[model samples]
Target: MAMAVPAQTIAGYDRFPWDAILLQTNSALMNNTDPNVWASQIISTLRSTAVTLPSVDLAHRLVSHLFWNHHSPIAWKLLDIAASLNLLPPLLLVALLSTRIVPMRKVYPQAYRLYLELVKQYVLMLQFRNNSPNYEMIMESIDNVLQLSQVYSHKVCEPGVALVEFVFSILWQLLEAILDDEGLLDHVPENKPRWLSRSHDMDIAEHDCINEMKTEQKEGMQRKNTMIAIEIIVQLLQNKMTSRLLCLVHRNMPSYWGSFNHQMQLIASKSSILKNLKHITADTLLSLMENIHGVVSCNTKSKLESNVVIPAGSQIAFGGQCEGSSWSSIWLPIDLILEDALDGGHVAALSAIEIITGMNV
Candidate 1:
């Protein structure tokens, strides 16, 4: 019989090969001609590892190194590998979120395509109920992506349009999920509970405190996500990409818009989302108007029935001494489109104008 190796000795032996493989992988990542092949080899090695080390950690390290080095080709190849393996490691996601497009575009002309792919993978991961190790970390990564997009909106290229669309869709779905879970549509309680005894009151107080903390935390996250969504919309409008943006909203409006609008109303009622909305410049609004007119004109020329409609009774009422209601509703996009068509003096705009005028009359 062959002699059994000592556990410590076997572990030491195992560490050497892994270390060597890691070193080789790093070196190869820098100069590999075929990134997919290199990525495949790295992934195979990682999956083949028999040790107790987590695969995600290894993935994180590789992604972190590729990002730090600005290795776009290899980084994208790794992303493809990760997607194929259905492994969306939070660390890798964070690294992708933090990678700035300006720098990557300077290095690689195809950076936008890679970024789009990353966004697509993020959307897929979010849509599917994968067993992500940490849901909070994934959410944080998404927040980072949104923040990054807002900061770099001016630098957005053609491919980045798709990225924004995917990001917005994901945000809408996430908001819907949050609202469905919390039942935010229900009426708030008006009265406080009375205690039966001092000890009982103390226990109830403690429980209330914990519950309040949890609610506050969830509310904070909702506020942040809402702000990011608004920022993205504003940025897209500023970039003169409103037509495509409107198209995306129109497509998803039927299924998610009601819940999404309700959530937005709740957010605006409590937070600074409305304040931010007030700051949108007139020029941006005019640009959005022009884009909407173009969309309406095209629909008329093609004889297509437009599904876009600024639903009636979508007024937003502000709290406490705010006398008049505002048009800062979540359905503001529809309102903009209608305003454009009614005001635009073109034959193509006539049909839409008549429809709205008849509805109001």
Candidate 2:
């Protein structure tokens, strides 16, 4: 199970001001103190078994000094050293960097890209354990990442396509991690017959009980994962991010859409949030279709080749009803586009006019 190291409070110094230490560190750097010296000392103290680490808030303030003073080479060196020693908390780093990304982006494009890469690496290192007991921390970390993506997407543009793509990739990983836990429950061994287990029946019985408890825990986790998945999907829709994300996928990852949609559908079905699933899904598809129409119309008016690439398998067909839920009428235009794409080699403009006309009708 992946778990964050809890912050440790120092005895007799519970109210120690971290700002003073940061100021001292900065003063030391100005006096030409080797960054390795001060950086190593701080990191060592944090890792020491005998000493206590500061509270979470103070810890963040101390570590964030490096990010806030990123103009100094000393700060970057310290961050590199901390990351090397696995002492840097991924969530804290993400929060700090993401909040300041707008200015960093404008002032230092190269540093912005490098720090964003580091952030991506840190996020990938985070994984939710099966039946982890640290629910609050894990959920907070997830929420932080979601908010980080929103900030990055909204504030950073121009050289921001890579950042956008990274957001989608991490979101997919988070969803997949949840799905993997659900997959584990399906393979749990059935109980052995009591008659056939006489010799080791006591141990067997205890094992069975443990397994039963684990199964129940996993079921509860599944419910929570479902709600999280719904939140992710809804945010993507509300921000209109999925359409651009699909274009990125189409250009570089043609095969992912199939499984991505399946994951979305499975997650939706598992939660009460699915009550408006059809409406939400329709709105998402309609937005994408409308964007496609506009792109095609522009290209046609200019008699230029279109730059749009439709996501492979974006044209999925649905019945009048799926399970008990009725398909929304808004899906009709999207369905026509899907049918034409399946037959016409996934061409972006092939049925765009017809679909738009159908929508108007």
Candidate 3:
């Protein structure tokens, strides 16, 4: 408000005072004597005081000083600036993954784009993750992704969902493995599976993939290690567990606009992923079908995981209530694949996954 008060005045606020500068420069605004003007006055004083400093941490100070106390659209504008400056915490990570953002969404003409902004944030996280920086950056990025996933679960677009699943799945897998090795499984997430420790547990009998080794040789060792990673994922997705979770979430979703939480739930299942054979189907699936209103168009399980990339042609379109009437269900070579019900939720979720994974396959 005070001519975007410069940083130099910040350090010297109490001396020459930016408030005086504002009183002189913005005499009209100062005349009102509104209490809201206090922030402006203080900032002006800060500018005059800080006029000598070479640079300033305006963004960091903004949140601590102003936005924390009085959040508003204007305050968010400062945050947007900080986000551009790599200052603000990633807020809409799930949004970016959905291909629902500005530039990326603009590229995909026909695919459903809902939460691209969140997914963009996710892409940043992945890039940072793959860059293999310090533990803090990786952890921060994963935290942001998980946070976005939870925050935007109901808002996810089906087409963008697989991408989200892929990114979060990989991160979760890595985190689980790390925690397990460190004896911190209970400290992290409890559902992780297929470790050397729990072979006889019947509660997860179906998720025996991680513990089984084809051989102990070098090649077998590599294969077995990757399998272990996938197994951890499967446990998270146990017993039609992912699909069941998706069904529960789809109920509250606003019909077609929602994300693929259901499909993510399905993807979380390891048996459904590795074996590609339906070992078990829930009886309550009928109720799940009723709720989704879309048929279990296909029940084929997937066999891909973190290292095993989703094949180039694996992605398929999902048509929900919009099926038959408006949206035509077509099979395209999408980078993402949905193993859930042929509904809106899964389709959107795949798009998000694509964005985060940055995988064309």
Instruction: Give each model's clash number.
Output: 0, 0, 71
Report how far off residue 53 is in candidate 1 (Å).
11
lDDT, residue 38, candidate 3? 40
Stretches of candidate 2 exceeding 4 Å from the true structure: 1-14, 31-36, 47-59, 62-64, 67-70, 120-361
lDDT of 1 by residue, 109-163 (tens): 2343344334333432222222333433443344344443343232322222223
305: Cα error in model 1, Å:
32
Each candidate: what lDDT? 0.38, 0.38, 0.32
State the lDDT of candidate 2 residue by residue for 203-294, as single tens digits: 21111222434565545534544444444445543332243333433333333444445555554444244444555553453344334223
Q: Which candidate number maximizes TM-score?
A: 2
Q: Cα-based RMSD of the predictions, in order?
A: 20.6, 21.7, 21.1
Q: For model 3, how many clashes?
A: 71
Candidates ranked, most accurate by TM-score first? 2, 1, 3
Q: Candidate 1: which stretches are off by over 4 Å? A: 1-21, 30-40, 47-56, 68-72, 90-98, 102-109, 121-126, 132-361
Give every collision pair in model 2.
none
The sequence of per-residue lDDT tens digits that candidate 3 reaches over residues 1-361 is 1123344533444635433543432442234233234444444455544332111233224433431133222333333333332322232222222212111211221111222223233332232211122223323343343343343342423323333343444334333443333344443222533222221211222222223423343334333333343433333233232333333224323332132223223333322223332532332222333444232223322323234444443233343332212333543223233333223322133333223322111
Per-candidate TM-score against the hidden true structure:
0.33, 0.34, 0.22
